[model samples]
Target chain A: MITFGKGNLRVPKWSKRVFMVAAGCSPFRKYFPEYKLEELVMMGYKMMLEDNNLKLSPLEIKDSIQFAVYGQFADHFQDQLLCEAKIHDYLGLDPLYNVGIKTGGATGGTSILMGAQAIASGYANCCLVAGWERMDEVDTRTGNFYISTAACKDFETRMGRIYSSYYAPMANRFAWAYGLSDQVRAKIAIKNRHYATMNPNAQQPGDHTEEEVLSSRMSAYPLRFLECCAMTAGSASVLLCDEEMAYKLSDHPVEVFICGGSHTLRVADRRPMDIPLLPNEKPGMYDEFLKKNPRWPGFESFLAARFAAYLIYRMAGIKEPIEELDLVELHDAFTISDVQTYGDIGLRPYGQEVDYVESGDAYYGGKCPSNLSGGLLGTMHAVGATGIWQAAEVFWQLQNRYDYIHGDPKWWKRAGKKKPKNWKSLQVKDPKQGLWVSHAGVGSHVTVGILRKAW
Target chain B: MAKPAYEKAITTKYIGTPLKLHDEKPAWVIESPRAMTHIHTYGLLTPFFEGLTKGKLMATKCVNPKCPQGSTWLPPRADCPDCYERMKWVKVPSVGTIYSFTLVDYAGIGIEMKTPYWQIDVAIKGVDTIFKGYLESGKPEIGMKVKAKFRTEKPTHTILDVCWVPA
Candidate 1:
């Protein structure tokens, strides 16, 4: 967290040891009928304290916290801007500084980055980053409207492009370019659900067969209902601290570093269209414009994610991500996004993600185990909390603290008679490094973070 | 067999018997009065809208000789994004091709169109930016020729004044 305060003061290079000491998540469900937003936040905070083995009371812990950051997707409650302040008061935390973040689905990861910056800049010894969304209370029609706020108001919204609709064209183009088959998409859906069954926190933690996924009602042309993320109610929190404080707090701290992030042009700006010429130009003006401004890779889709991943890999000193990183957790809002992201993140070549998916290299115990936490597909998508959940999963995996669930024949029977080929052990023997990527606002805002286990 | 402690607690709290499982629904439906309002001074885009009323599509072009971005923008901006200089409006040809499109299976809020409508990004002739609109008729296809069908009789002074049709 670089302190963008007065003078834009920079933290000393030596004090750049930011570590994730503790992480907690509320049980993901379709709806939290028993609790409200503030209560859910408090529950997550308490769980984080418990996970860190801090037996101190809420007030005691609050006094030690120097700063806090909160992330929420939509206003489940009436007060939108003051939600973070309300949560701070509800938790009885007297942090020196606190702020709220609303970056569509990327809020969780962005909040984590802010927390790390706060600790790294010596502004706070410990910072609490939390994200939650109570979406189940809203009807489908209302929810669609709120989610569409992430798109461009003047162009996308006015043109009647909703959240799912934005991805529809991307899916269409990808299928048209790569000849993406239904079998490949169904496989991706089944793989995520299969991993979800192993996760107790998963909202839809049941095995889904290929036939079930293929037969699911289509939401968009290429995206089906089962292939989409479930609207969920949950909260997640992570505690970040300086290097010295991290060692004193936890035996195994996952050292996290924000590699890089970028915001891309709007969908209208980068669409595959020729540049209009000036009135005076001759017949060769359009061709001249093309020469000066060649078409870029992001013109198709996932532009920001591609740009962010390139910077991240470069910052982490990783020349080859597929061979270097132990695991990756992507924001798979739609199954097509997962397929597109694999190539965007440089795990595989563009348009060759179908080969990677068909090869079973993305599953657990494969070449590159991705979304072992079931991703957004298997794990419930609380919108704002998803990015934080992805980071927490990496933290747990790095420390080997997560509950390891092996292949079970009984669970397979419940999801229909389909079993994964290599379900031997979903656990990574020793993961040194992992990456977490998330996006918001129609692929405009993207944030990628790299986590390395500090021995 | 005796009921589990957790089950007994839940049943006792609600009623003597266990609570019935049912599909979850919101307690109340909120009809939100949502409206997207923009106060445009028409500082630079006045002529662009005026062109639409006359059944003409227009864009802004940077007159600076050395300016990048090819001195052109669709849905024109006040200044050139690259050179940051004032731009002049120019008439764009109505005939274009579909750059990309999506069939809206579900209509969104504030959208007056019926379901199963075609929303397209039409690349106007000689224009760098794609103009977004719905096709007047016929299914959308990539690279398919399309021409602007403006509501010249009753101009709305909005982007909706024009629709795309097969050329």
Candidate 2:
């Protein structure tokens, strides 16, 4: 049994407050041969410097940066090592110390966490966090194999040479244990893909019906092709600053609260333990849940996500997440993964995750809409870029520029696509706070970050 | 006179095949093929894989009394995570109940088994953790009883050596 000591229970406290000033990302696609990896990173980097309405000039901001952090998931995919040095030098920020962060799919969020820590620790007044993945370097199956190796090579990777097979068993167990249905799973795909229709950066946008999702090609039993995010080639970036540098950088700066948690690499090795309570939950709230589910985070749930949420909610001092957070950008790598986070993050109590979507809380114009940027399911899952893109989406929404960023014809032209005449604005009205979950390797590493509007 | 004349002068040539161009549309994308074999050691867990080929399932158990959990591990670990103590190998029952299952229709590159196979996670009584294996030939469901079937004749010597069949 894994028990948290008093030291472990202590919430993370920053030496100084951290703030996010700007965010940017390139249009995502399954294959991007038009630009080299460095050039693609430049595309997003330039957007962050120029487009976010920062007070300082792009070069002035560059001159102000004290350090940089890059997140790239796998060297096998890149076929090159020390990509940070190349990217750092390419960005014209030579001689500035930079480090690379890798935590599977959570690399992006972890990079941001590192950047935020630099600001929080007074190590840097201004820090740059950028992440990217070029999955098109290999064919789809080879890419999947590389990703699957992230699973425990000895135990799990040999069982199913694909990642979806890893999640499909969980889906089966969850459906059996919680009385969840295939219909509920299909709805998520339809919703996220439909939401993708509005995203210029979305790689796969469609107005798919429930039938279409249900009838799609099966990757694993009960999980169709559309239920999973495809490999993407793109990059995303965000800038973090200390409190003093925040107002100097932008008229709209967002306060950042982020913390991470990790569990065993093998899902089978997860020992049952007490569900760490969120700030709003009570001591015995999950007692009945424990009695029913037995294993608190069995194949059905993620302890890493739960643990991260447990710490972040307390660190951010959020009492009721469903009520407090205005909008959310979840790591919807898979539909089930998206739904599973609802309970883990206290969006719903343990047994009522489906109700979050059923109750319309996860939809646009709902109580707390999620994945308003179409999420990983719709837009992209350039593994390392995903979490940064999620944060950028929330940052833009909090800035009330969702329409300008996502709805403008200029962005459409940049992506080489015509803006749809029926494009709908997914802007959450004047948002105060939002949260995003960056997860990796069957809930191996997860970071829950909250971005509160601080103008 | 400076050099005592090397037995064979160092000579190298481009014996490697030219890497094929993957795509040449906007940017010249070249295919860089990587073929490698990792020297993996089972180490203390060698007995577990070796036992699979011998029609036995070996698990590692922590016998320390001070340890909070005296758990047995399949995909047996050398040390107990709870107390950081070395665990001893023990034989576990080869039968288990299906806790969960899935049919993998399409898989990644380098998949050994044939497609549309049932992969099951089996929960043995003594083992604290569920073990994953493929069902040999049968439909799978939760709570279905299954027993281990090893590949003894021509052992793959991998985890694939041990599979499950309907009990």
Candidate 3:
């Protein structure tokens, strides 16, 4: 961990608020307004852009803005040279020199961390990160086909499932192995949306009843449309700068610091071709394969959470159970993902984390208030940008900038005298540790990262 | 359709017994991305890959002729990490049958494939190995012989060559 002295550079306390800035997100629903899914997503993106004062065409703005960072574009960003050129032209920044794109799930948080690190290292006086994706340009099925490539397409998709199906294999494994219930997975969905209702930036908003989430149309046996995140066109950006530059540049600056980052791959991801349904190595025998790679029984969502948490804790140096943290921002790509991440992250023992949601501990104003920024479930999922966006929310919460449109809580009790603070501080109570968890699954490819507030 | 490698014998109990599966004698070889010294990054290789275009399957083989695990590298590798040798290129068979399968209803972020279809694990003969691929036609069942077929927008260079078919 690194810390800068006030003497390093000083403009004003207000500038201290954002000595370094990071990330701007645009969640676009206007482009696909006919669907409720699209509308919620649009609102989410719009809120992100509006909060940042970011007004530029995606092309004109690709990399020219302060602390320039952008999302994945198959034709543009995918082509490193084109992306590099766009960065130079739009942000007037040389990516090869100081710019680059960090994509995939949780990319939003990773990018923010990248920019934050640059600022912390004094590599740049100011930096910016932004991500957005528009699903309206293509029909749902076509868009999904492209997205499915993120997983082990040949193995997972060919086996009758897309990326989401990958989670099912795990979900099945978890359910079979740990005895987790579908109802528990449903609680994750309800809790996430419950928190999302407090987050104005979220694409989907509602105080989802547990019954509604459980009974909603099952996209898969254990997952419902309510359980999955909506495809959204939105962008988010954050600016970062050294304390002195930040002091001079803006008021209400949030001090940004990164604790740590780590990444790991899952089993199916390790082997694509011949990724056996079962891994027993017997020649001329299919039965052996099935026996070795028994369909992982149980809910994948819970498993994802547990694995993610495990990785996060390992990186963040938290020996205590992860539930100790005050806030969490998981991928929640699907509601089940939230349950899995919670368990995977070790917030609760296996098969027990979903109870955290029921206890309201994962809810806004509850202990740990997860996805207070309305997670991917409420926030549109722009692939790599999703994680980066989670990081921004953590930064905002730590800085206590909950009043902005981007800072609205995902839920609120109508009768409460005052709205809840977007920020929740465990530091005052624990004073030792705070953690953030983020995850991404591209087909069979899954990676998790954890961040801690610098002490 | 070819007769299965196994013929259900008088003793049906033996059928329920699990058998060990191994890569066929000739290891499946697929093309390697020459630019990448190791396994080619999927995104970067898509442009140069011919799998999508020729309706063929591609993968890399261990460069080290001496490595014992050379035959096990799927998606092909450019080098044998264990022995540190550059890999040779090879093409996998496009034909095979459903070894097993699953249906995915819900997809993750950025996924579009819908539910209620088969995701089959097919075995290619020339490549002589099982590869997971979509079966556009026919339900997935053990010993359901199938062949690889290509999609409409066949990119001259891609891995989505022959999709699985019920032969």
Q: Give me the candidate number with maximum TM-score.
A: 2
CAPRI tier of model 1? incorrect
Using lDDT as the yardstick, the better of models 2 and 3 is: 2
* TM accuracy, model 2: 0.98
Could you tell me how far off, in angstroms, the CA of residue A445 lies in candidate 3 after the best superposition? 7.2
Please list the residue runs of candidate 3 whose C-alpha ends up more than 4 Å from where it truly belongs after superposition: A1-67, A73-102, A152-161, A246-317, A321-324, A349-360, A403-434, A443-455, B1-102, B105-115, B118-167
For model 1, residues A66-95, the per-residue Cα lDDT tens digits are 899888877743336677888888888754
Among all candidates shown, the one with the greatest DockQ: 2
Residues B50-111 of candidate 2 have per-residue lDDT tens digits of 99889999999999999988888887999998899999999999999998998999899999
Give the candidate order by descending TM-score: 2, 1, 3
Report the TM-score for the A-chain of model 1: 0.84
TM-score values for chain B across all models: 0.74, 0.91, 0.59
**Residue A351, model 2: Cα distance from true site in angstroms:** 1.0
Interface RMSD of each: 4.3, 1.0, 14.7
Span of 10 residues, lowest total lDDT, candidate 3 chain A? A272-281
Tens-place lDDT per residue, model 1, B42-89, is 656877777778888888887888874554678677787667788888
